[model samples]
Structure formats: structure tokens, C-alpha cells
Target: MFEDKIEKMNENIGTIPMIEYEKRVYTPEEIQDILGVSRTTIYQLIKSKVFHSVRVGGQYRISKRSFDKWLEESDEEL
Candidate 1:
């Protein structure tokens, strides 16, 4: 079922060649690597709701889209 959904999503994306989609959910560790911040900072950001995140089984999952949006907004603020 998962494979089928992925295949269907890929097929849909293939129809729009101009659009590039990366369906990724980042773990806190991965976000830290991307942001060059510590895990504690990541948790703090999650706690402060600096960006959107969903907690699953005591772990927070940050969507790439939200992270990018937050980055863009922060850059504009600066």
C-alpha cells in the first residue's frame, strides 16, 4: 500500500516536470545538521513554536516546507 501510494505520487509529479517535489520530514538531528544548531535548540524552537512541527511518540517531526518557510521569513525579518 505504501509503495502504491509512492508510485502514484511520483506519477502525479511526473506530469508536472517544472515542479520539483521532495516529500521529506526531518528529524531533530537532521534539522540540527541543516541549521548547525544543537538538539537542545531544536527542541527549544519546537517548544517556542518558532516553526511548525508534529510530535510523534515523543519525537518531533519538522516538515521541510515549514522549515523552508520559516527560514525565508526569518531572513526577511533580518
Candidate 2:
């Protein structure tokens, strides 16, 4: 039942656009790869709120915009 609506929605991509917020998130693993850091360090930053993030369900979802802005302002070499 729900699958039919999803299929219909996909077919009408022109009329129904994807949400912008959905594209603005970064996962912990992606952050690790980008920063060359470990999972522990990533969580530490998330906990410290060095950038914007929110706990969704059991895990954290970092904002890509906030993270990039933090990087630009910080002295940390990428």
C-alpha cells in the first residue's frame, strides 16, 4: 500500500521535490574519513558541540553546513 504511494511519488519527482534537510547531514563514518580521525574522536567532538548536531534515535546526525563552517573557523588542518 505505502509502496504504491512511494512509486507514484517517484514518478512525480518534478512536482514533488526532495526535502533540502535530507541532503545536509553527515554521518559519523563520513566525518572520520574526512577528518582522518577515529570514531571515538568524532563522538567527542559531537559531545562537545564543536559544531551543530542532533541525536536522532540511537545515533548522532551532524549538520554538513555547521561542520564545514567550524572547519573553516578552526585552525585544524584538514
- How many residue pairs clash in each candidate at the backbone level? 0, 0
Q: How would you encode candidate 2's per-residue C-alpha lDDT over 1-78 as one tens digit per residue?
A: 999999988898788766775569899999999999999999999999999999899888999999999988885665
lDDT of each: 0.87, 0.91
Best by lDDT: 2
lDDT of 1 by residue, 1-78 (tens): 999999988888757768687867889898899889988899999888877899899888998888889989989999
Error of 2 at 20 (Å): 9.9
Which residue runs of candidate 2 sit more than 4 Å off their true CA positions?
A: 1-22, 75-78
Scanning candidate 2 in windows of ten residues, the lowest lDDT window is 14-23
Kindly report which residue stretches of model 1 are placed more than 4 angstroms away from their true locations once superposed.
1-21
What TM-scores do the predictions have?
0.66, 0.66
